[model samples]
Target chain A: MKRARIRWHILVFLTPAVLVYTAVMMFPLFNTLRLALYTRIDQERVFVGLDNFRTLFFDPIWADQFWNALGNNFWFFVIHMLVQNPIGIALAALLSHPRLRFAVLYRSAIFIPTILSFVIVGFAWKLILSPIWGIAPDMLDWIGLKSLYAPWLGKEEYALTTLALVSVWQFVGIPMMLIYAALITIPDEILEAGEVDGITGLSAFWKIKLPLILPSIGIISILTFVGNFNAFDLIYAAQGALAGPDYSTDILGTFMYRTFFGFQLQLGDPHMGSAIASGMFIVILIGVCIYLFGIQTRMRRYQM
Target chain B: MNKARANPYNTAAMHGALILYTLIALFPVFVIIINSFKDRRSIFREPLALPNSESFSLIGYETVFTQGDFFLYFQNSMIVTVASLFFVLLFGAMAAFALAEYRFKGNLLMGLYLALGIMIPIRIGTVAILDMMVATGLVNTLWALILVYTAQGLPLAIFILSEFMRQVSDDLKNAARIDGLSEYAIFLKLVLPLVRPAMATVAVFNMIPIWNDLWFPLILAPAEETKTLTLGSQVFIGQFVTDWNAVLSALSMAILPVLTLYVIFSRQLIRGITSGAVK
Candidate 1:
C-alpha cells in the first residue's frame, strides 16, 4: 500500500508534462512523417506511400536541387568538421593552460558571438564586407593584400564557403566551452605524471590530454553535424530565403523554409515541406544514433 | 623561474596565435560598435580608431530610435523569454523530480521519449504547428512565440532538471514527509527552493537560444507590433542597406545590451555550464 501510494504520487506529478510533451511533440512528429507519405490532389491530400520519396530522389527537377542541397549540406558539415572543431579545440587548449592571463576576458570576448542573434552577426558581416563601405578592402589594404578583397558573398564559388566561414566565426565558442569544460575535468596529477615521464608541453597535450578528451570531442562532433545540417538562420538572414547569388548558398534549412513558405514565384507546398522535414529528421537521427552507439562506445574503450 | 630565455619562444608563439585569433573573432564587433558613434566620413576614413571628441556622434542611434521600435521589440523578446522560462522550469522540474525519485513502470521509456526531442529540432513540426496556429488564429502574436518556445525548451529543460533533481537529498524529503506534510506542500515549500540553483543553470541555458533565435520569430510573429529584436533588426538593417550609419547603429542597438549582460554574467554562465547541472 505504501509503495503503491508512492507510485501514484509519481504518476500524478509526471502526468501533465508527459501528456503535454506527447500531445504536442510526439503526435506532430509522427504526423509529419505520415504527411510526407501523401501528396496533394486538387488541394485534397491523397495517400501515396513512398511516391513523394520516389519523386524526390528520381525526378529530375526535384532530384537536381535535392542532390545539390544534400551535397552542399555535406560540404557544410565537412567544413565545420575541418574548420570549427579544430579551431575550437585549439582555443580551448590555449585557454585551459595553467595560470593563463586574462583568461576570462579572452573567453567572454570570444564567446560573445555565440550569444549573438544570427540576424545581428549575419547582417554585421554583410555590411562589413560591402564594397561601398570598403571596410574589408581597407583592412586588407592595411595588411598589404587589398587585391585579395572581392565581393565574396556575391560570387557563386565563394558565397557558400564565405558564409560557412562566417558561421564558424560565430559559433566556435560552443565547442571551445565544451572542450574547456572537459579539459578542466582532467586531474592535474595526470599531467604532472606525464611531465615525470619526460613528456611535457605539446608532446604531453597530444599523448595525454588528447586521449582524455576524445569523448568530449566526439560529443562536439555529433552536435556540430546535427547543427550544421539544420542551419538556416544565418543564410536566411544574410542572403534572404532565396539564398542567392543564384541559390549557390542554398542548404537544406533554407531550402525547407523556401519550400514551406513561398518566396517570390514559388507557391507554398506543405506536403513537400513535410517531406523535406522528414528527411532532416532522419539525417539528424542517424548522426545522433551513430554518436550514441558507435563513436561513444569506441571513446570509452580508449578512455584514460 | 629564471628560464625566461628558454621558454620565451613557445610563450611568444602561444600569445601571438591567441591574440591574433581573438582579434579576428572580435574585430567586426569592434568595428561596428565604434563606427556607430562616428560621422559617416569619419567611419569610412577610420574604422579602427576609437571615437574621440571630434568623431563622436549619435546620428546612428538617432536613426535607430526614431525609425525603429527598438524598445518594443526588446520588450517582446523579454516577455517571450521570461514567460517561456517560467513554465518550462516549473512544469519541467516537477516532472523531473517525479521521474528521478520514482521507479515506476515505463519510467525508462518515458525518459527516452522525452529525450527524443533533444535530438530532433522542434521546427520539423512547423507545417502542422503553423496550421494549428493559423486555425486557432494565434500566429502574429507573442503568445505563439511563448507556446512554441515552451514546447521547444521543455525537453532539454526536463532532461537537465531531472539530472539535477535526482541528486536532491532523499533524507530531507523523507523527513519532511514524515512531518505530516502533504506531497504538494513539501514540493512547493521544500523541493522547489532546493533546486533553484539548478533551475537557474537551466534558465541560462534556455535563455541564450530563445533570445538569439530568428526563425520562429520570422515565421510565426513577424508583425510590426510583434517583431523580436532579432527580426526587427534584420528587417531594419535590410531597409537601411544604403545608409551605413543607420545600419551600424541598428546592429549596435542589438548587440550592446547582450554584450553588457554577457560581461556581467560571464562567470556565472560558465559556472552553470560546468556545474554538471545538465549532466
Candidate 2:
C-alpha cells in the first residue's frame, strides 16, 4: 500500500513537465517528420506518402542543393569529430597531469569561448579575418607567413572548414571537461599499481587512463555528432541566411532556415523546410542510436 | 632531484604543449583587447604591441558611445536572458517535482518524453513556431524571445532537475507527508532549498547559450528595439569593418560582461560539470 502511494506521488509529480515537453518538443519534432511525408499542392496539404522524400532525393533542383548541404553537413560533422574530440582529449590529458601548475587557469581559459555567445566568436573571427582590416595578413606577416593569409570566411573553398574549426575551438572544452571528470573517477590504487609495475608516466596514461576514459570519449563523440548536424547560429552569424558567397558555408541548420523563411527571390516553402528538418532529425537519430546501442555496449564491456 | 632533473625531456614536452595550447586558446582575445586601446593607425601598425603613450587612444570608445545605442541593446539582452532563466527554472522545477515525486501510469514514459527535448533541436519546428508567434502578434518583442527560449530551455531543465530531485531522500518527503505537510508545502519548504545547487547548474547551462544565440534574435526579433548584444555587435562590426578600433571595442563590449561572470563562477561551473549535473 505504501509503495503504491509513492508511485502515485511520482506520477503526479512527473505529469506536468512530461506533458508540456511532449506537446512542445517531441510532438513537433515527430510532427515535422510526419509533415515531411506529405506535400502541399495549390495551397492544399496532401499526403503524398513518399513523394516529398523522392523529391528531396531525385528532383533536379533540390537534389543538387539538398545533397550539397547534406554533404557539407557530413563534412562539418567529420571536422568536429576529427578536430574537436582529439583536441578535447589532448587538453583533458594535459589537464589531468598531476605535475601541471595552474590547471584551473588553463581549463577556464580554454572554456571561455564555449561560454560566450556564438555571435561574438563568429563576428570576432570574421572581423579578424577581414582582408580590408588586414589583421590576419598582418598577424601572418609577423610569423613570416604573410602569403598564407586570405579572407577565409569570404572564400568559397575555405569558409565551411574555417567555420568548423571555429566551432571546434568553442566546444572542444566540453569533451575536455567530460573526459577530465572520467579521469578523476579512476581509483588512485590503479595508478599506484601501474607505477609499481614500472609504468610511471606516459605509459600510465596510455595504458591506464585512456582505457578508463573510453566511455567518456564515446559519449563526447555522439554529442559532437548531434551538435554539429544541428548547428546554425555561427554559420548564420558569419555567413548570413544566404550562407554565401554563393552558399559555400551552408549547413543543415542554415539550409533549413533559408528554405523555411525564404530569402531574396526564393519563396518560403514550409513543406520543403519540414522535409529538410526531418532529414536532419533522421540523421541525428541514426547517429544517436548507433552510439547508444553499438559504441556504448562495446565500451561498457571494455570498461569492465 | 638528480633523476627528475635528468629526465627533463617529458616534463619539458608536457609544459611546452600546455603553454602552446593555452596561447592558442587565449591569443585572439588577448590581441583584440590589447589593440583596442590603441589608435586606428597604431592598431594596424603594431597589432602585436602593448599600448603605450605612442599607441593609446579613446577614439573607439568615443565612436561607440556617440554613434551607437549599446547600453539599450545590453539592457534588452539582460532582460531577455534573465526572464527566460526565471521561467525555465520556476516552471521547470515545478514540473520536475511533479515527475520525481509522483507515480502516474505514464510516469516513466513521461520522464523519457521530457528528456527527449535534449536530443532534438527545437529549430526543427521553426515554421510552425514562427507562424504561431506572428498569429499571436509577438513578433519583434522581447516577450517572443523569452517564450521561445523558455520553451527551448524547459525540457533539459526539467530533466536535470528531476534527476537531482529523485536523489533527494525519500524519508524527507515521507516524513513531511506523515506530519500532514501538503504536497506543495513539501515541495516549497523541503525540496526547493535542497535543490539550489542543481538550480544553479541548470541556470548556468541555459544562460550562456541563450545570451550567445543569433538565430532566434535574427528570425523573431531583429528590430533595433529588440536587438540583443550579439545581434547588435554583429551588425556594428559588419558595418564598421574598416574601423578597426570601433570593431575591436564593440567586440570588447560583448566579451566584458560574460568574461567577468565566467571568471567569477568558473570554479562552480567546473564543479557543476564534473559533478555530472549536466549529464
lDDT against the true structure, per candidate, is: 0.85, 0.82
lDDT of 2 by residue, A143-212 (tens): 9999888789888999999999988888888999999888877777777777778776678788988888
Q: What interface RMSD do all candidates show, one decimal each?
A: 1.9, 2.4
lDDT, candidate 2, residue A201? 67
lDDT of 1 by residue, B236-271 (tens): 988988888899999999997788767776777888
Question: TM-score: which candidate is best?
Answer: 1
User: What's the true lDDT of residue B113 in model 1?
Assistant: 85
Best by lDDT: 1
Q: Which residue runs does candidate 1 get wrong by more than 4 Å? A: A1-8, A301-304, B1-6
The residue-by-residue lDDT of candidate 1 on A130-217, one tens digit each, is 8877889988998899999999999999999999999999999988998899888888788887777888888888999898888888
Off by over 4 Å in 2: A1-20, A37-49, A301-304, B1-9
Worst 10 residues of 2 chain B by lDDT: B1-10
Q: State the RMSD for candidate 1.
A: 2.1
DockQ, each predicted model:
0.62, 0.53
